[model samples]
Target chain A: MGPIMDLTIFGFLVQDGLTTGAVYILLAVSLVMVFTVTRIVLVPQGEFVAFATLTLAGLERGDAPGLAWLLVAAGVLAFVMDLSAARRRGSRRGIAAAAVLFLAVPAVLAAVALYGIGASTPLAAKIAVTCAMVVALGPILYRVAFQPMAAASPLYLLIAAIALHFVLVGAGLYLFGPEGVRTSPLLDGSTEVLSMPVSVQTLLILAASLGLNLALFAFFGFTLQGKALRATAVNRRGAELVGVSADYAGQLTFALAAAIGALSGVLIGPVTTIYYDSGFLLGLKGFVGAIIGGLAAYPAAAVGALLVGLLEAFSSFWASAYKEVIVFTLIVPVLLWRSLAHVAVEEDHD
Target chain B: MNRRNKSACAAVLMGLSCLAAGSAQADITVGVIISATGPAASVGVTQQRTVPLLPKEIGGERVNYIVLDDASDTTTTVKQAKKLISDDKVDVLLGPSLTPNSLALIDQMAETGTPMISLAGSGAIVEPVDDKRRWVFKTPQSDGQMARAIIQHMTSQGIRSVGFISFNDAYGEGWAASFRSLAEQVGIKIVASERYQRTDTSVTGQTLKLISANPDAVFIAASGTPAVLPQATLVERGFRKPIYQTHGVANNDFLRVGGKNVEGTLLPGGPVLVAEQLPDSHPAKAPSLEFIRLYEALPNAGMRSTFAAYLWDASLILKAAVPEALKTAKPGAPAFRAALRDAIEGVKDVVATNGVYSMSASDHLGLDSRSRVMIRIENGGWRLVP
Candidate 1:
């Protein structure tokens, strides 16, 4: 008990917490964006993390991942759907564009992956290729699973998200067996900061997370497309009436969420071992952070995720067995406070 | 006419009796339940691979092995055990790999009056020799034995204080309990003790707390690839003290996942892990070499695992007991199970791949300090240490 309160221990806990918090912050921001624009929780966000890590590991071993094949299949399916829709709507140009973007993009990525296998590719290339492969999965997933049900009730979308999580988890197990894999660190060295040692990989994680957050801020604040997404989040029917394509906003949000999840996977793969089923728990922690922000504000979710990470670190030291319980219990207070502060209003129908 | 009919009746009766005697000497069926697809799959895979290497005929009786996957779930283990007993009518039961799965099937085994040779490492599987556990036996050395070996090594190194990071499961708690009592006996104080889940992504916080205690060494009581998490985190946080792991992680996957981080780490393992490196005069050498030869003969056999040797030893015990049991009662009968149990208990000085096993009414595991050897990870392989 006496040693638990030591300042040095506190500092170490903070460092550890922030390192993990950075990844959770990315996940929380993705969750907030996806929920705000689409009114659906991205339950399978962790699957992207697992796929990215596994893909990187496969590349390190000089083997092409099964994800390469999955991506191509999804791309082909999405293109077929788009082509039929365009033909029905008498838009020949749309069909041609869809074929190039969906079919050609995945075909090129798959070819690169096949060529990279058994070859000594650069690490940056592997990282970029894996991230792109996973991000490319986003639009296809939206077109297949969510786009048709875009106007469904939030409860119905939540159920669909959960179902998608199971499908991805089953697919992950089939693709990457039950064995856990760890990749070599992207940056492999440590340095002392204020008498505390920190690894270069940890620094990379912090920097990358900061960069992504800033990029997201700029994307949402300045770009016309970002404003359209914001308008949809504020009032979906109003945005639709104003000629902003709801489908585009939904697809973009999912794409952003997928990219964030994959990047988080690549960043943390070296820090911890990742298994096929590991993503669900990690994503749940992010969901907890999202809930703390009332599922609306990005900055609040980021701060909440950092707090969750810090609490997790400190509580593990104090009571390791109950650390999960303590971290999850935080949401109860936040929920109670929000419920008491805000008056209930019935949601408007379309 | 009467003499001719009488002679024909005697000949027919003799032929029927001979046929009955031949049918009584049929195959002995051993049902195996192992986790081939879940968290324990790494360990269970090796155990499963050993099944093909078992002798097809034990004492002139053809042995039929029925293997089922429990998926590392305790309820599934019990269900599989029940199905093997009632449906397959297996003469004896072989496994239910992990500790929790093995422990869960104890009652079911006792109720069914079938002998279970478990491959798990927990002492509770055979300890106290209660009515329920009397039907159960395990091949791996008990946690208590390995704990004492670690404590002795620590004492010889002049280590007075140690920290522990254990998994929050039965295996972890079992080691923590044994390690605590053994360290106390050796005058070593436990400075810090922490627990983490097997699926936990990061143990940095727990590891930092452990380092803050400033112990001379830290012992991690986790198994498989997950065991690498805490140790790696400790190194990341710059803890330069000696680190030790439990025998549960004595496999190639641990070394692979751990990479450079686990070099020079110490752990106690079965002699089979570093069989080639052991001295020729060592008791485990001959049997260990034979197991390696037979296992490696199979196409695509990757690396020799100590977990596989546990099943190999179980087969050895079965090989010695099957003949004795066959003499008393036919296979799959109530009397046959009782006889097999007694025969296994009566086995004496049987050299197995892991160690020389000698089971008794009070002792089911039958291995001692001779079964364990201290090992270190050097150059990505297990090195035998003095």
Candidate 2:
């Protein structure tokens, strides 16, 4: 508590928070991509990322075991298994069912590789596990959950996925036990040379991490046959009548979005630990980040995350503990204002 | 003649039988609560591997110690402590590690009246619990001691510029306050003091902020998950000032994570990470060297960690207290425990593999200002250069 308005603490905190915001921004944009397609809130997206970091850490540590090729083979096998199943189910039968399973594979592999195998393998095994899971996730989720949920209101499904994600994480912790989750840099002194202590480095890491996430979402939005997907989210019949293949658009959207989410998870290791139930926090933050960005604007969602992150950082300075509690509480007023603003604009239009 | 021979034979037989019984009764039972299957498992491995061996090295009559897994969960830890006391009926208790867990079970002291030694440095644990009792004793000095030592070193360096970073928790908060207060007390300025949550990945932003302040040194008070953040960020930014870390980083896990970045870390007792360079005559050498030798002989030990030494220390204290505990035991569970606690806490001149440990109702923490030997991590190993 330096002065009424001491910029010293505030300045540092804001910068710290902005970097945190970047992580949220990346996560939020990925979620928005999935929502845009199926309109179903997806919960497993964050878990995919959480598991990715674990796999990467394992690989870097040289304790993952098994040949790297084997993991790559596993990815190809899972992809084939998913596609063949879809092809068998009338090449169309249960998109949602298949998508759910695809999203789940990475988490399952991560749990097994971590607890069942322990730290026996090497870097290749871990990379294989991560690649196999990530490579398989996009193609499978697109074929399964997104394609099926596109025709229905997806709010319920999103809620169900969130619940399921927690259950899985809880079960993993129980099964694996929390004994071996602690991680260090995969390699030794070499990592030290890469880490920077200056504000510029901190800002860059955050921006890069956050920017990578936003770019993935942007890939889905303005590019990648956006016209075909938007038609289905709104003018479903007219878009189809013109030439949009609603089925493929739904598949591409979910696949693209889920891939980005999983990618973020892999990169998030140095940012924080990969806990069993880290997704719940990430999902909530990503959702809030999406809301902050007007729930649809990619850049806006990212900005919202940055602002929120800064706020969280400042609160930490005043009281080093309870940073999360203070920041989560602060979001209420901003959300309330935005909600009211939305209703007012709607009424004006009406 | 027959009467004389029979009497003599019976006496001889009786003497031999007594010797046999004495040899059989030589086994000792001490109890230790360690987190085997939880977040701290890496550190817990240290306790599991070292505590049981303390009895063997000291050549106690017979060493039988109970090692219970706390499962890294609090509720399970209390139940395990009760089990060790009631079921196993150990003579003395070593630890339930972590500050919070240690505080949780100190309540049992009222019921069991057992003499327990904890390995955590949480300052609040050592403070009077309403001044009625000092039953709870900690081996590591309170966070205040660590803070004071660091501030003194910084002052001696004549460096007024400092940067402080800590995780956001009770442990970190207490450590930060002590460090800052001591810094200010010594007429030193904390240029950029920043904190992060345990969940944060990088301390890059925080380090940069401190770098911007251009402090001559950085003091870190982080532990657990975010333990790697500051050093990693500091090294990454290539800002190679002298960094003083709290004893929170004594665990080798930080070195494993921090790697070559570990070279600059300054800690208690001068610098311990630079172990090889310590004078051959230094007291610290015997215990750590002996423990490492014993651990290396065992197949299941960790790559290398400070946990081994910490556990060895906790066990040696319990061994010093065991004999008096067994003196009046009735050879039953309840009576055996009662006798052991009474005997164990009365220990004096208990020189452990770590160092000489002496305790009283007034002072429980073993190490203080005089004990510190500052060292650093030099060329990928510990060399005492202080």
Candidate 3:
């Protein structure tokens, strides 16, 4: 017999959708932020999530995460580039600042990864180390991979991002092995809510998502760096004229994207088993949301992603085999509406 | 002067004899295609690791293996298979490490008249013994054989209805098809059926649907760590019924990933899973223990994998058939390839790590009832279900 539609089932499905949607929201916001600021779609956003989860898993197992070494390597590359650039400019203070950001920070984290984080480490310490290790890579990646081609076309940047995604995925496999991992839940047990069972982990996820989004709103609406990023997104030439360093904006955007991705991973790790390449599909789903927003609107992307999550849940219940098809097919009508609503503009070829 | 002259003469004689033997018997080349780097890497890496452990020389002729990674792509698998057959001219081919890849290679194998020993799980790799599959053989136990074992266990447990969740691909679909037919024979009903992608992050809706149907048990037909998602979700959602899994999750990774969620899961798997637990009288016991000993002795051995055992069995089959093929024709010739295929088909009572293989014209997989045992996950390890 097929499942009968019932209130309990609907509640469970909604809870599931919201939980997954929360993680997708974090990813969608990051995707939009990076896309708007850098003119590059961050295809490797999912890698950050996978790396964070796997890093925590590695810490739980008491093995030093291989990602730390990657951070060190990237740090060295970025440092060299910065040192050379600073030397050409003949700025001693810039050299010192570069040394601090690109060298000292990664070295300290690498040391922590090597010695401090272990099986006996506290959960908070482990998560802190995991996030620091992953988040630091973001700026390093920007400086090393994207800075040189900051003036390149979006399509060219898109190709580089895709290539970067493959590199990270391959590196992830080497670091985490081929097996999937799921962390122990941050909080244990479930309780009744509205006559339905609600997991504490689900509550934590919802709370974290809400808190992070609020923090993001406050940062963007209040902070000078955030306004600079917004200015850079609106027009790089105008932002440069207004004394906003476009380079700093790109680096700051990448840092935020990585932090959001890492947090998403931390929350999602306990809920699902994640593999090295699991990021691509997760990122692709968020991308469907980013597309729904035309890659420019944050609230729209968030809403679109949640809708995608709800549609996924309902379709899985109704036609489990075609859930992916149904979920992805949503973009068709959305793209159609968006294109029809807006008139074509003159080409702004760079 | 006498010592130096005598040593020189002995070295010359040894070199002459080696040359003669080399001219007399050409080295046998066995080409292997594995999905060592992509989605199926969990399965394929173990099989790839077992390659170096395979015999370097079978029947006194040096065996050289040319292993290629398919990266878990079907087109890449076909390309590598063609490269091995036409370029390397391997005497016998082994593995692309997945059902879809193995199925794709059938036409290529048949056209080339090359003998292939697939290491994938699907029985469709060699079923019907048609003109195409006649050249293809596999080492893994068929889905039908394992299905009967599971159905027998369900009957013993007095479970009348079950919920089925499987992957949308061949491995899952093949298991579902076999299990359903067997369940029907025993008058057990499958109350609900669901399919999922391997990479799906959540199965909440599907699990909710299954729970609503309220079967006596849930049967999960999936492989690797992906299989853990459904069982874990079920436990999280308060489904307090028996959960049955197929042999696909017979690896240490699954145990490590599933942890407490997979405790009490019942499955039908190869004898290799519980080698030490098997009674001495069991035909598969000695080979299983021997296989385990060799596997554990490897330099970088981590956890024993059933996928690795399949490759080891493939090697055993190769060792058994190489001498017979040699009797008819020399290595690297078209005749030798045909002879090798015939020899593999004629292999009889070759006890392997999984089971005893007795091949015939009609059956190519060669595994019998002795290959499988009912097992339960107890205290995070496999225990024989009495």
Among all candidates shown, the one with the greatest TM-score: 1
TM-score for each of the candidates: 0.93, 0.75, 0.92
**Every model's TM-score on chain B:** 0.90, 0.81, 0.90
How do the residues A23-136 of candidate 3 rate in per-residue lDDT, one tens digit apiece? 888899899999888899999999999999998888898887898899998899999999888788887666777788789999999999989875677898999999998889
Q: Is the docking of candidate 2 incorrect, acceptable, medium or high quality?
A: incorrect
Q: Candidate 3: lDDT of A133?
A: 85
- Candidate 2 iRMS, in Å? 4.9
Q: Give lDDT tens digits, candidate 3, residues B66-169.
A: 67778898998898788778766778999978888999999999999999999988778899899999999999998888889989899999999999999988
**Candidate 2 chain B weakest lDDT stretch, 10 residues:** B13-22
lDDT over C-alpha atoms for residue B26 of model 3: 80
Q: Of the candidates numbered 1 and 3, which has the greater TM-score value?
A: 1
Score candidate 2 by TM-score against the native: 0.75
lDDT of 1 at A235: 94
Q: Over the stretch B224-309, how does candidate 1's per-residue lDDT look in tens digits?
A: 88999999888877788899998878888788889988988999999998999989888889999999998888767788988889
Q: Model 3, chain A: how large is the TM-score?
A: 0.96
Candidate 1: segments with Cα more than 4 A from true spot: A4-6, A80-93, A117-119, A192-196, A345-348, B1-25
Error of 3 at A236 (Å): 2.4
List each candidate's DockQ score.
0.57, 0.16, 0.75
Displacement of the residue B189 alpha carbon in candidate 2, Å: 4.0
Candidate 2 Cα deviation (angstroms), residue A245 = 9.4
